[model samples]
Target: MSEFVSQLSDSLYAVFQSETFVLLNTVDQESGGPTSSAISWVYAVDHSTLRLALDHRSRLVDNIKANPRVTVTVFGQDTIYAINGSATVTQDPLAEVPFKMCCFDVHIDAVRNALFYGAQLVAAPEYAKIYDKRAADKLDSQVFAAMKKA
Candidate 1:
């Protein structure tokens, strides 16, 4: 069995300092099932804390409100990690962004290595925004700036 660490390692913290491909998992309030969402506006506030932003109208808001426990799956440092944590809404509508954005604070509980034995990751996941480049860049810049602040 893989060992579970209590917080993000230094390498993971550095990886999360910038926007990256990640999966946010939450519990379904209706069916009591696990729900997952792909997210990029995730920032590591510290080794044990993270800050994330999403649209205020995103269903993830309701999911977190219903159940604070969440897991953020990230692929970095040649492996996959499940960052287990509890989350809470810190901001309803972020003032810096032109659009309404919701911010959440996640306090990490344990980080588990999710990769199977003998499997090696060749490359980290990458994504591209399909929208207007200028608009997307501006939005990401604003959102990340807000997330980085204490």
Candidate 2:
């Protein structure tokens, strides 16, 4: 197996336990270009798949239906992890939550430590420090913790 595939079962979702949000990249249907956006609600359904919440009118939602392949990257204070996966749209993820929301079940295919490459293979704190002050406002602390358990 490849290094990226090896990392999948080990530390893929380990680092994301504390992360509130991550950068989501969806391919544009017409242009076939990647569009980056910060998704506030995302959680791991299991070790292999992550559930991503997308707004009803979100372009990302449409993009995913057109193309299930995508990437979700998390930049933390000391590490950066990216997951390359395939997404499937799940309608009405949460009944309590208002509005029409679409959920994407992303099956993680590969994982990479973007900012952590060196002689010793350690995370570069310098790169992480840049995003220190940023936080996802819509993040639910309880839900984040719950997913980790699930």
Provide the lDDT at 29 for model 2: 86
Q: Pick the candidate with the highest lDDT.
A: 1
Clashing pairs in 1: none
Q: How close is every model to the real structure, measured as TM-score?
A: 0.95, 0.69
C-alpha lDDT of residue 21 in model 2: 68
Off by over 4 Å in 1: none
Q: Give the range where candidate 2 is weakest over 10 consecutive residues by summed lDDT.
A: 124-133
Angstrom error at residue 109, model 1: 0.4
Task: Report every candidate's CA lDDT.
Answer: 0.88, 0.66
TM-score of 2: 0.69
Q: In model 2, what is the error at residue 146, expressed in angstroms?
A: 12
